[model samples]
Target: MYGCEWDDETGATNGFFQDGYDGEDFLSLDLKEMRWISPVQQGFLTVQKWNKDTANTEYQKQYLSTVCIEWLQKYLQYGKSSLQKTVPPHVSLLQKSSSSPVTCHATGFYPNEVKISWMRNDEDHDEDVDLGELLPNEDGTFQKMSTIRVTPDELKKNQFSCVVEHQGKTIKKTLTDDSLPIGIIVGALAAVVLLVVISVVVFKVYQKKKGFKPVSASDDGSNSSAHSDAKA
Candidate 1:
């Protein structure tokens, strides 16, 4: 139910309008595609509901349902436009620490119209990347692969990204390193800190027991009196 042309110059879809507005307990096409809706799935729909007495904004269930139906009717009538005009953009992140190669492939394109490049921290990759051939599809679409041989030092910046340009727009998706698993690292650090705290508590108890010696004052006084009598 998307890609509904607005006017002559702006043939873009009205999907953005639906995106801006929201409804409650109502029917919807897809989030992006905005496909068609069925009558069977129409009943029990609730959009923005209002009070009959006060005529104020009471519940939004009935209101959203009405909006969805109106948008769907217009969407079906003007949704005949083709999605083939713009090439679908895609980027993959394949991480490899081996000496072989790190390759990423992207498909769903309108051949020769989309351009892709490999970059390491926004710099042009010269000797590292090996560009692959573009394969064509039955619908005149194309797919391409780009590979880069990254060194251990190059991966230190932790900012490798793939840049794709098509239809006067640029999009990028960053690559993540396999060596760094955030959850595991945090768990290991927590375990180490717990062990250190337990060890410190155990050491304090051990020292208190070893250094303690109990004595009575009456025994010392009697021994001193007997020693004074012997001296007299």
Candidate 2:
């Protein structure tokens, strides 16, 4: 009979080979029945190991790919909705062209993390730009706003630009100047001012008319006669 154990704890597999060994550490060919079962069991074990290894490899690949996609999305700021880890920052320029110095305000920026600045040509804007509040995103990033005072000349040559920097990436957007038809706006305002002035004058004239009273000479005859007597 052959002695064999199928588990390490019980010394099953090795036990069979150990007890079945001949005078040397080798087994004799006459121990066919005992050795035969080993080949079958080894085949089964090999198949099981191959399946487990394949499954583990596939899982690792999938996990690594997912991690890579997430890492890229944090900086890319654009792409698949599922991979949209960061919201792209937006900016708008607000201008009051009629004011002495045209006012430019910029709003909307994201990861909520960034710095905003204004430039004239390419110089640092000192008093020209007023930085506003830095808002936060739900994801813990930051958003900041800023405004700049631009002169007519700057607006004309398109010398002003708004710059945003985040995570070492810089984005610059050229400022746009929307022409306000001064003639039309001023004409309309003038028409209104004229209307107001005319209304005021008319009101005054109406009050004068309401307060005026005609005096009759016949009612003042006694006073006039006394004045004539004194003169005489």
Candidate 3:
């Protein structure tokens, strides 16, 4: 296999080639350090090493130098744009924490740089807001939440809004008393259904384990017939 590993944060990179599993030391490079730690840096040196000859380690030095330069140029030119593209976040109301507490959820956005806060009657409200951390999404995006407690009286007197800033855009989602996010509602219902199903399965398993059996329809009918005959 032939490929390179580059770390954007520390500017560390390595380029290497391997012939096969349990193969001879072929070509390896610490491109960032500009050092040859093991194996020959050139294909010819690799061939020489494989054949047990005195190998020229820098035989591929010029080529590796060129690769390093190109790598730096790519990072300088297109690194930020390659994996740093922005995606607008979806904002919605989460399930309320209490009768008065409402949470605003923002999800599925890249870059993870987001601002979440509350707005009361078109004014910035921060003292009561509880902002959550940037949680990673399975899709490599991010999710976050911010909650605020507003009483029914205050909600009736003033409008409450969650302002989310991400991807160079501002999203203002209004908080409502009884409305939960559609995703949250569906997830909750699915969870409850799953719990009920699991409970039933567990109950059946426990009953079987205890040698308890359910009465069949015929057995119930037989018992009813015996009871009627006894009364007669």
Candidate 4:
């Protein structure tokens, strides 16, 4: 394997060139000394032969120090935008049921580095907390979840919150009835109302198409005679 490393802050660069035989180190280049180093006796002869070629050694040193560094810089410049980008996460507190643990889920964040913890009354709480593994999202972002087990009585007596630290920002979600699936209930009710409205509209359209009219108690027998003539 051979590669170059660059330190942007210090402007320092280094390179390495190595060869292996049968899963053992055979020959390696020492960039500082401009020489080939061999760890085993079998490679001593090959190392001696390579060391005698001063012209080639000088060429190798120049290529590793200058040419390799230039290529590395170009690659870094091409990928700078994607490598340095940061995206904040969307945080949510979720619970399946009253007896289940509350999960704090954070998703759609970039860079994959985050911290999740629990707090009680503004203080850190670690008991009965489970930290989930970092997962990848389909959009090239990341997601994570942390769950805390607490009783309903304890939640009502104290303020419990989930804290998420990501991309230099902090998000806190408090445990409350709002965290439950209330939105689902509202959506279901809305669907039912919509269905009732549609049914009423259809019924009115059918009545209109069939030439139906409201019959009042005071209507004369003329309306009944007209209906009988139409049926005939």
Candidate 5:
């Protein structure tokens, strides 16, 4: 496999095999550090040989360094304008239980620099906010989260929200009060719906069983004739 450089100042990694570009299946290497970081570990014979050869070619460092720098420059210059975009966050509020902190998650954003806040009654409440770090998504986007603690009494007031600032847009998501009761209500409603459906099905089956069944045409005529004879 192939890898790329990690820029410490910018806190990003680049050039990860380009997703269908040139890459070997089992020969991983760090081209910038000149190290076999994977597949050719320390105890391998191939590692020993490669290390020896690399040490012998110390004079080639200048050329390799130049190539790495130029490659980075070319990619940074050509790709940034077209490939980079700022994606807005999708905000949500979650809680493990009634007593847990309200975790406000802001996921699916790009550029990795976003500000998340937990507010009370439209005012910033920093004392209760626990800001989390930016995390990378599988699609090369970023996600972040923040949380705030709340008591049951405080939750009853229902004046809490999570706000996100990204790409010059502000998005706020409000947290609901008494989530446990709401969940119970929803579950009870579902159960009631299920019961009603079951009752309707059972009633239909019972009615089908109790429904009148007409006799054959000849039998009905014979019964009517017998009744007429008895009445006469």
Candidate 6:
């Protein structure tokens, strides 16, 4: 492999050309000395032959130092738009249940650099906190999750929040009762109500199909006896 390195801040440049054999260093080009160096015995003859070729060595040096750097700069210029693009993260607080840890989840961010932490009463809190790994999204974005274990009472007595830092922006999510998985409870209640309504409908349909009539409590015995006399 051969390449050039450029330091934009320091305006420093360096180049190297190295060859390996069977995962071991075989030969390397020394730009400063304008010679080939061989660390292994098998490459000694090859290095000697290469070092004697002054014209080829000069060309190699020129390509590594000048031409390679020019191509690298051109590539960087051509892809600057995508290389420097930044997308802010969308963060949320999630929990499986009241007894579970609260996770600060951030997703749909670009560049994959992010920081997640917990804060209590406006101060950093790291106890019982677990930081998750940065993961990739299907849309070329990134995601991460950080969780904190705290009791319900602690949440009520103090202010707890999840903070995420990405793309020079800060996002915070405060722990609230609304953040709890109350939707699960509401969904369960709704299911029970639906079941009761279905049962009532089914029972009414069965009664109608069986020709069953409901007896009223207001019917008198005299009315019943007159009906019987008429029948006689």
Give the Å shift of residue 111 in candidate 1: 4.7
lDDT-sorted candidate list, best first: 4, 6, 3, 5, 1, 2
Model 6: lDDT equals 0.87
The segments of candidate 3 whose C-alpha lies over 4 angstroms from its true place after superposition are 1-70, 76-81, 97-100, 178-188, 195-232
Each prediction's number of clashing residue pairs? 15, 9, 0, 0, 0, 0
Order by TM-score, highest first? 6, 4, 3, 5, 1, 2
Give the per-residue lDDT digits (tens) of candidate 5, residues 1-232.
2334646489555443211213533343444666543352433565456556875334344434455556876787798874567788888787766777878888889888899987888877887778888899998888888878898788778588888999889998888774553445567799999999999799788878999344443667887787667669
Model 6 root-mean-square deviation: 12.3
State in Å the error of residue 203, model 3: 13
In candidate 3, how many Å is residue 216 off?
Answer: 23
* Residue 46 Cα positional deviation in candidate 3, in Å, after optimal superposition: 37
User: How far does residue 45 in candidate 1 sit from its true spot (Å)?
Assistant: 80
Q: What's the TM for model 5?
A: 0.47
lDDT of 6 by residue, 1-232 (tens): 9999977689778899999999999999999999999999999999989989999999999998899889888888898898768999998777767777788889999889999988999999999999999999998889999989988888778899899888789998888754646546677789999999999899899999999765444468876676666668
Best by TM-score: 6
Cα error of candidate 4 at position 155, Å: 1.3
Q: Against the hidden reference, what TM-scores do the models get?
A: 0.38, 0.35, 0.49, 0.58, 0.47, 0.62
lDDT values, one for every candidate: 0.57, 0.54, 0.72, 0.88, 0.70, 0.87
TM-score (C-alpha) between model 4 and the true structure: 0.58
Task: Kindly report which residue stretches of model 6 are placed more than 4 angstroms away from their true locations once superposed.
Answer: 1-4, 14-62, 182-232
C-alpha displacement of 133 in model 2, angstroms?
1.3
Q: Per-residue lDDT of 1-232 in model 4, one digit per residue for the tens?
A: 8888889999998989999999999999998988999999999998999999989888888888899999989988999898768999999887767667888999999899999999999999999999999999999999999989988878878899999998789999888743555445567799999999999899889999999876654568987777666669
Q: Candidate 2 clash total?
A: 9
In angstroms, the error of model 4 at 46 is: 9.8
Q: Pick the candidate with the highest lDDT.
A: 4
Error of 3 at 54 (Å): 33
True lDDT of residue 89, candidate 1:
55
TM-score of 2: 0.35
